[model samples]
Target: MVAASGADARKTIHPLFIRVTHWVNAFAIFVMVLSGWRIYNASPPFGFEFPAGFTLGGWLAGALAWHFAAMWLLALNGFAYLAYGLVSGHFRRSFLPISLRGALHDVLVACRGQLDHAPGRYNAAQRLLYIGVILAVIIAILSGLAIWKPVQLQALTALMGGYETARRVHFFAMAAIVAFLIVHIGLAVSVKGMLAPMFTGRAEAPR
Candidate 1:
């Protein structure tokens, strides 16, 4: 454990590997999102294009390179993160045993701005959201593979309801991830000292 000062004491809440993978995954996702937007602009998936200025990669070819590079990074880093989480018992320790009743209660408490913030334990709402985001990421990756190699991965594309449907699913998964990122950043910034763990591998514990 680590320590801070006053009522906002801190402890070594995050391990070194967790910290590394968290930042790596974050960067990978960031690059993937921006470059993906540029790539999408080429085909206009929904008949509308993302603003070029707000996207990364100058053009189609550039975007494809960036997107593919980031995709591999995301996959490798995510796999490592998941493996470590499981092997280290982090997933069970932090997110398991979530009951529906407990989750609902926690959600209501969160709505009232009263969720607990104990060290080393995730609240029900956080556990649920985190799990949901993980599932979304898996969906995004699968759908992306279907879109990227429809011929080679015909089974996957067919499973996802064909090429166009897989494209739409990938888009929606990306949208969900973006939405989760917005909410995650908002919540982290809104709380004092909440961002320290990912950066310093520690967090302020309550007195």
Candidate 2:
């Protein structure tokens, strides 16, 4: 058995498929969230509505157009990601076990400013977060479908506890996804050189 050379040990790259899917997913989410907000404003299930200025697509019809288009993009990309993860063992290698104790320990270390990151390797906390956000996105997609075609998807709507309940579920799922993005982006920007590797795919461990 041979150990990796110093040069090889110092560098790694994100897979091309992972990088491409990640960026596409980011763009799709941005479009979906803003357009969905616009659609929500039309009915306002709750007492308040999103400000028109902050939402996409000026009007309800226009918003629906954007929302549906982005939804298809998300769905297709998600399928590809899942397929790759399963076939390539990426899911098992990257986020398997879902250890709560390990994640909590990582959080504690991070609080003490002791956590260190390695390229192409996720810590316990990160693994948990990635899995959680994936679930949240899946929830948002299902609930959105329930809301979109209640009559045609009567069983799904009923499974979600009726139309109104589904809307609330959808909104909260979107909120969870948004919250994850905030932390994810904050971490990328705060950690030196983290953001660059995500875009360029190549990563180098600083000495």
Candidate 3:
């Protein structure tokens, strides 16, 4: 019994540290999105505004306050997670060896509803999706900073094709991230017991 328990303990799929940082990042993103919507509504780039009920804060100033606070949390926490993921080899184990062919196969299988997951491992589709979203987040941050400080970060604004372009980029990046989030949430709920490991850390050992 003792030996079995020891083996089971090694099967943890989402370590406690990962869980903590993941939740913190999620919260930060949640706040940033809602507050960002409010900020965007003040001078919508697309000529339409998010429903006030779906936004954070009562007005532009309040939204800016919340957005800036959450932006710091997201940036700091994201850096820590990225450092840990790289140094601990977690990224290697979980999201690696990506290739066009492999992703295509996964997509095809997924479309057929025949895709499956290996315990404690990511499928190609999951890896690609995660990678894409990470990039999107990075883009959002850069474009947002440019929009938030066009005069101060003149170089960044220029890199992003000036202030007007940066705003559009930020909007599109946020939209992509939101779309990925919807799909991610749907999969988590639809897949049997898939969401438990993130909270509990351990999962059934692979046969």
The candidate that wins on lDDT is: 2
lDDT tens per residue, model 1, 1-207 = 334454345567888998899999999999999999998898886878898998989999998999998999999999999999999999999889877788889889988988876756788878888888898999999999999999999999999999999999999999999999998999888877778877887666553
Off by over 4 Å in 1: 1-10, 205-207
lDDT (Cα, tens digit) per residue for candidate 2, span 13-103 = 6777988899999999999999999999998888999999989999999999999989999999998998998899989989988899999
- Report the Cα lDDT for residue 88, model 3: 95
- Candidate 3 structure, TM-score to reference: 0.92
Please report the TM-score between candidate 2 and the true structure: 0.92
Clashing pairs in 1: 9-205
* Model 3 Cα lDDT, one tens digit per residue, 45-134: 786899999999899999999998999999998888888999999989899988778989998998898988766889888999988998
Q: Against the true structure, candidate 1 has what lDDT?
A: 0.88
Give the C-alpha miss distance for residue 64 in model 3, angstroms: 1.0
Q: Candidate 3: which pairs clash?
A: none
| Candidate 3: segments with Cα more than 4 A from true spot | 1-10, 205-207
- The order of the candidates by lDDT, greatest first, is 2, 3, 1
